[model samples]
Target chain A: MSTVLTQRMIELQGLTKRYGDTLAVDDLTFDITPGCVTGFLGPNGAGKTTTMRMILGLDAPTRGTALVDGKSYRDHRFPLHEIGALLDAKALHGGRRAFDHLLCLAQSNGIGRRRVTTVLEQVGLADVARKRAGTFSLGMGQRLGIAGALLGDPAVLMFDEPVNGLDPEGIVWIRTLLRQLASEGRTVFVSSHLMTEMAMTADRLIVVGRGKLIADATVDEFTSQGEHWIAVQSSNPAALAAILTDAGATVQKVDDSQQVRGLKPIEIGDLALGAGIAIYGLTEQRATLEEVFFGLTGDSVEYHGMLGSQNGQAA
Target chain B: MSIADTAHTTPARTERLAVTNHAVPTQSALRAALVSEWTKLRSVRSTVWALILTSAFTIGLGTLFCWAYLNRRERRGDSIRSLLFDPTARSLNGVVLAQLAVGVLGVLVMSSEYTTGMIRTSLAAVPNRTVFLAAKTIVLGMVSLVVGMVSVFVAFFVGQAVLDRDGLGTSLSATGVLRAVLGAGLYLTLIALFGLALGTIVRRTPGAIAALFGIVLILPLIAQAFPEPWDVRIGRLAPFNAGQAMFSVRYDPDLLTPTQGIFVFLAWIVASYLVAMVMLSRRDA
Candidate 1:
């Protein structure tokens, strides 16, 4: 309960990183405000993890600064007592027992033994704590890593792809834990390739593509923008377009067929029925962050067309 | 900056221990880092075997070398006292390789963090870079000390046993014997520190190990192959060959003596460690 809290928890101001000729993080600037689960969302190579590394002071920024609580991570005397992170869950000594690994980390931060056990219990790993980490399943490792992150009860926390190998139950557990940590006035910034997971867990989303910030807004706001569109289908496509146009809605042709981009699905459906357009198929379409992503990402041709996506996961 | 901190300063010296006030400025952070690293060391079973193997190899080689070299050098000398052995020098012959083992282990203890991306977690937990590196140096240095002592002592006993067979001995009371033993331990410690520096610089286990071999093994070998003046010139600069003088019992006026060689070894260790700190500060882990 005595979690030492710091206000500006984590901040990145115009952070940039380059590996030889390639820039991995490009002039990225964002702040992880306290008391919320700010979801760091991106496609492969979007620099979420790179930003995390810079924040932790593991990577020296090429251009700008990454600060934790208004100071650099290097300035903190007892950093673990203030912040915790699971940058990579598998970044562990696989041969050591879960208990020993957590205990050692705890000892480094001057956290007591009782708190180790408590964190283990909280992460539902108390029984498996004695088991060597190598034998644990990936989900178990993620849990153990999360347990380690909580060992210090720091006011700020970060996790990079924490659910990569986790099961549904483990994912739920982490989502709840992250939300709970934030509720206790801790800053929680988590990065994930799983957009759907972030949609569910993160109150706010910071979207990036091609190592640049695409959007930083509430989840609700992102989802709201895409809700006005309707997918219309009919044999008399031109007739339908004409009617929709007459209704003061914008329409475009997609794939030499028909593209409709205005009004609710129900309104379109009613209009189509009344106009005897003989609809083949009709569905409501929301311009989700996913769709906005598609629209914005398709334009990111510099990397896609020039170099081709090269990480294990393709663009 | 606070009045509170000033007021809490220690008063005039007293017999009673003032653990809180008199502790080193960065000791707690250093201690925390040591604890973290020690945990990491024990978590891997390979560390135990590495220590055991180093000691066994050093002792076995020292004994073998002592048996062969002693029998040949003192075979016909009949002063009786002339055969008195230097247990210290004979015992430390294995350190040449044993130090490599401790050095490799020290390198892995750190560089592996970078190779595997665990450095992110480690640095995030303990963000003060200088304090973190200082703690690593202290803890790893201490481990190397203890391991080096055990290996050197074991080599001494085994070598002593072999010399006993020939009734040829090296005097443990000799002027340089104690210094050699201490030097052997100090040498191993320096090697470990050098390994740590290499680890920080290369941030790759294989690269660091290769660099170590190049510095400690190749430089000396390449130096010897050169013509006289070049050999002497390069030999003076290469670290281990110069540092090895510390463990020798006999003084050679033609070469730098054991005592003088120590300063070079220290210079190498200090320079490398400082370079490591610089690279560590600037590089992306």
Candidate 2:
């Protein structure tokens, strides 16, 4: 198990991809180790797909190298056994049957027909194996894509936006499958723009913005990094804000409520009592992962919708 | 069933683990790619339809042309025999239309991958571009060769049966008759490869098909607009005219000899294929 774990690591060293003047994937460096589902978190156009394509050798990086088990993906004679990737679920011939699609991929890697059948059954697509892939729903297409990935029983798996079109049930199925793959000491690297989804599935998070690595930490560490504050409402909000400020806690007034950071709920209550303020509400609010992601990537977002009118209303 | 149910109930996981423990036997990448390419070619409906059209047009049209020739000979008497009588070329005239069907099949072999976005999946599985393209070439070439041979031979035999009614049919033992029949199949196979090369270079169905038509059908007509000797010279060099020269036994001052025709036609295919190989390797999938 330990040997397999070590052999399944994916290493990207100063990997960069530039499309003419635009840098799609900057000089990002990271190692995805086995036994965990590492969520590649990035906003749209943040280069997550570009990075995955480079790792799979589907696209050449402008600089640096992406290695699977310390060798370039192209150098491996049978790369499917080393790593399986589902970069785009729809990147298949629609005219082909589901079974034939997987079979062709399997045969290319010297994988047997039996393994193709096994993966079809595993992905719950055995019933629709004979149907043309064009006839499948988006979720069924996702399943067929996954079955192609699992055809060789590879040690490392990479999925790009795997849950995009999945139903709730399909989403749960993939999350469990990713965890099971990792628990068996395999490397599982999945990309998503949704932080909440990552929070549920990923053990570690590799967050990127504008092709730059923002954070690489465990999920617990990342969540803990978000600001935790106590929301306080009082009759004398100004007095409560002044007292909280004096007590070394940063206080911001939002409407009639004072948001207090660097102080616990118990400490805020004591401060209010000492100040003789009538406290109406005191509730602790930890920033959700979604907010943290937005905060980290706000400046790096490529496109922003017009929200000037809504901003004045909030103010 | 839920993932958990499948995970625990099925022995797939344990079997996979055991399979991974054993060292996989090393197979040649080219061989694996060949098997994969064959599977891809056979699984698609277009391949079947194109081959059927190829055979149908070749045999059906060949018979129709032969019957028409016998009727014309009957009306004109033996006076037309004093001119240029190449019954073999007459019976195999269907290759003119059949080339388009086979060429389209060849174009789809390469261009459809790009149009369908299957190139990414295919390249991911077989990262070696040279091996992947080589395997495709071998499969397409072989399939086209076999289909071309079968179609042309059946067309020859069936058309001869129709032409025999007027005593105008040529036997295989006759001078240049067997070579003409066999050369027709080789000509179609080369055209298929030519279309594949064009498809790979263009990487689009409509663009590649248009380019193929420009070279095979329109080029000869365009050459005719040129003046005198140059017109005949350029016309002989056109891919379709050059291919026609291969199967035409009757000597004509305008058309190239069979040896010159094959060499010139092959040069076109080889040049296009080289450009395709360069683009395929340099460009990102």
- The model with the greatest DockQ is 2
lDDT by residue (tens digit), candidate 2, B183-218: 899988988888888888899999999999998999
Strongest candidate by TM-score: 2
Kindly provide the TM-score obtained by chain B of candidate 1 when compared with the true chain B: 0.83
- Model no. 1, DockQ: 0.21
Query: Would you give me the overall lDDT of model 1?
Result: 0.75
- What C-alpha lDDT values do all the predictions have? 0.75, 0.86
Among all windows of 10 consecutive residues in model 2 chain B, the one with the lowest summed lDDT is B3-12
Q: Report lDDT (Cα) of residue A183, candidate 1.
A: 69
TM-score of each: 0.84, 0.92
In model 2, where do residues sit more than 4 Å from their true spots? Answer: A1-4, A233-242, A255-257, A269-283, A305-315, B1-22, B73-82
Scored against the true structure, residue B130 in model 1 reaches a CA lDDT of 84
Pairs that collide, model 2: none
The number of the candidate with the highest lDDT is 2
- Report the C-alpha displacement of residue A67, candidate 1, in angstroms: 2.0
Q: How many steric overlaps does candidate 1 have?
A: 7
